[model samples]
Target: MPKIIDNLHEKIFECSLKLFGEYGYNEVNMKRIAKELDIAVGTLYNYYPNKQDLFFTVLKKSWQQTFFKLDKVKETNYSSRKKLKYSIKILYDEIENRKGLGKELTKANVIKKESLDGIKDRLDGIIRNLVEELKKEEKIDIDKEIEERLIRVFFLSVIDMLDKYAKEKENNIKFINYIIDCNFK
Candidate 1:
């Protein structure tokens, strides 16, 4: 039945997400995904042409989930500084939760560099919008260019620290708090 086929399709996607999360992007293959879903490799290929296509679908799904949470944060009636802090925390928690998977994804050759670049650009746009909103609420006393540059630097620093000190939760919190206090104070 069409309903049974749809259910199977959903199961395949769920299995793929778990496998990718556990084994990393490059380590997971269509055969393994199909096996995990109790389906044949040819069935998997029928839905997705290749492993790269499947992985990209998974990545886009993950991004959509993240953006949904962020949209909620943006809708809250909190101050811009508070919103920024929450946004940073969301990103930090996501990266920390998938630390190994993220590192592996970066190293995977199957994923194109342009794909990562596109993700970066999207994230940058989100951060830039947050910074612009904060500027409206606070007296930053800086030129637009300088403000944008500072926000970019801060964003990069947070990402770097998240990658470098992922295991040190206390230290990471301290660093994030320090950055917020210094910049948003």
Candidate 2:
């Protein structure tokens, strides 16, 4: 019985992720998610009392998956520039793939402002780790504060450009490579 309950919970989470990723939090409701999972609304509520709870649960899981991938990239035997590129590519791909849901969440203010800050802080920590790895590789020599600032600027600029001109994939890579070279070289 516990195993069956676990399976039902997993099904709900999977269905919620799909619906939330495709339709955004504002447009998706518990009823829709339950229907998509072929579960009763009461069962869905038993798992997640409210939409916000379910949304945050899914968001937390997605962030964990992203961090796991980034951690794997960090473990790779690649050059600092290559590592940074791969990390950025991972982020860029995620953003591009979920552009619609991202825009919807932003436009609808579905996520709280403080939650956004938390997400930014987590992303910055990943960048900081990358920068630290680069430092260990003797690829960059700068004060910690300056390095962090530069990373923040570069990351934000790249995201902005990608959001604005997502179709220019090659150009984006070139632009990112240029920045990496100019900074680390």
Candidate 3:
């Protein structure tokens, strides 16, 4: 089992995310993070070797939280296609709701090195499940690999579009539904 961090580490992450989200990553330095945490700069280093590690941890936490939310809403009255649509809509809604809760993806600099592979892997896990369920209902061309790419593309395309729409405060259920309608068909 993995080691659990103490409350202080959690505080560090929370404070860091809040400040980073509000001020932009470039302006939120270790001194600022330390000041917000009410701890010395050296203390945070015990939890994270450096700012990059902290940022990476925050990004991973965000992804995991997103996955958890998706899992909670996995059971719905929609078809597999609709389920996927709802899952993405849920993601967009969460991002919009939590826009200032953490660092903005577009502006995040500390965690820049994090590849899309982590997101891709998590997404593939979801899509694989969807494909399995979808297979039970209809004949899908799983062997050619084209089907897999299409699912990934469809998901990414819709999420990216909805993410773009999220820039405006008004919850764009129509925009979310639009992507859902176009992609999850």
Q: Quote each prediction's TM-score.
A: 0.79, 0.77, 0.68
Pick the TM-score winner: 1
Candidate number achieving the greatest lDDT relative to the actual structure: 2
Candidate 2: Cα lDDT at 114:
71
Q: What TM-score quantifies how close candidate 2 is to the native fold? A: 0.77
Error of 3 at 152 (Å): 5.0
lDDT of 1 at 65: 75
If ranked by lDDT, best first, what sequence of candidates would result?
2, 1, 3
lDDT for each residue of candidate 3 in 1-185, tens digit (9 for 90 to 100): 53344688678878876775566556667877987767778777877887767766776776788888778656766677667667766665655544443324444344554544576577678867865666665554455475666666645554465456555433555555564344333
**lDDT (tens digit, per residue) of candidate 2 on 30-127:** 98997887767888898888998888777767667777888899889998768988888887676566555444334436866676566567778888
Comparing 1 and 2 by TM-score, which wins? 1
**Candidate models: Cα lDDT each:** 0.72, 0.73, 0.63
Q: Which residue runs does candidate 1 get wrong by more than 4 Å?
A: 1-6, 104-110, 142-163
Steric overlap count per candidate: 0, 0, 0
Query: What is every candidate's alpha-carbon RMSD to the true fold?
Result: 3.3, 3.7, 5.7
Q: Candidate 1 has what TM-score?
A: 0.79
